[model samples]
Target: MLITISSLLNQTELAETRDALETVEWSDGAKTAGRTARNVKQNRQADLSGSRGQALHELLLRKISGHPVLQAAARPAKFSRLLISETADHGGYGDHTDNALMGRGAARIRTDLSFTLFLSEPARYEGGELVIDMPGYTQAVKPDAGDLVLYPSGTIHQVAPVTKGTRIACVGWLQSLIRDAACREILFDMENLRASLRASLPQGSRELLTLDKSIANLVRLWAET
Candidate 1:
């Protein structure tokens, strides 16, 4: 399911990250792209193995781990490294899907969902909308700073080139505990309904119990070991 979580980073945290990224060294983004994706990726990325990169990763992980909305939607089993990317000089990535598998050996993660945590304000950039092709429609997502959009890993997506100013974002992927997207979608909907029903109906109502049980069963059916 395609979803946008807002205020992922508080005002203070967002400002701190933006300040740090202003002077952070960046390398060619193509270095990490797959063979075909590399041809169209023209942005710059931070050295993900460096000290600054590690710090960014830790900070993001801590924040993500505590986000209830992200926890419900992503159900992340393992998260990949945070890639701080910037686009300027009319730079951006063309349509491409992320690698199915990331890392190696014991640290391997199967990408089930992809997320782009936008740090640049919408007004700061001219034309760098994140376009994701869904089943029958194309969604152009250009969230405000401190917001993030998450989509299925296999979706065909691309970043429109920046025309006027620089666009900065932290991109990453995660392997979800619930492998099936449809199943997770159902659980998410059920949980949301459960919350609403709890407030509208009595706590011990039969409707709540039935929905809560259904959610448990779906989680059991979809959750991966």
Candidate 2:
């Protein structure tokens, strides 16, 4: 399952972050792709390990780390620093799965979650929609500024070519505590239902107790630990 969260950051924060992004040095992305996206990949990506883009990378990472929904879905035991990408001239990310290898000689760690935070306004781009292939549902999302899109890292997904201006965004990977999508979906639904019940029920209502118990048991049944 994929989740879209809007307005992950305020206008002032977005502006400051965008300004910071301009200072980071960008490099060609063609080497990362083969033929499909290579022909259309004209933008630059900030080097996460380099010293020049440290500040901007840190800021974006901080924001994502504190997000409630992302935290719930990612269930991240560990996360990588933020990486920025600026795509233009029909810019798009070709279909590619994240590499599971971690450090120089550490045990292989799976990439359980993937996130894309939109840094540009929706009107600025033409066709840079995110396409995710699900079992029966095909999700196409192009969210507004400061919005975020999260999905399973195992899924084969791609970014549609951007025909107009540039598409700027931040991307990151997460190693989740619970990696099963089915279990994650069930937990996410329970959390949403819990919120809804809280809003509709009076304080100390008997129904609230029943709902709480249901949620607790579900968590016990599905929790990875």
Stretches of candidate 1 above 4 Å error? Answer: 48-50
Model 2 C-alpha lDDT per residue in residues 1-225, reported as the tens digit of each score: 788888887899899888777666678977555455476455678765655467667777888888888876666666765668888887687665555534233434567788899999989989888888877887888899899999877777788888999888887777766667777777777777777888988867888788778767866676564
Clashing pairs in 1: none
Least well predicted 10-residue stretch by lDDT in candidate 2: 99-108
Off by over 4 Å in 2: 30-42, 48-52, 100-108, 202-225
Expressed as tens digits, the lDDT of each residue in 20-118 for candidate 1 is 666567889999899999999999997656576667778877886668888888888998877889998899899999899998887789999999999
Instruction: Tell me, by TM-score, which candidate is best.
Output: 1
Model 1 weakest lDDT span, ten residues long? 47-56
**TM per candidate:** 0.94, 0.83
**TM-score of model 1 (CA atoms):** 0.94
Candidate achieving the largest lDDT: 1
lDDT of 1 at 15: 84
Please give the clash total of every predicted structure, in order: 0, 0
lDDT of 2: 0.76
lDDT of 1 at 151: 94
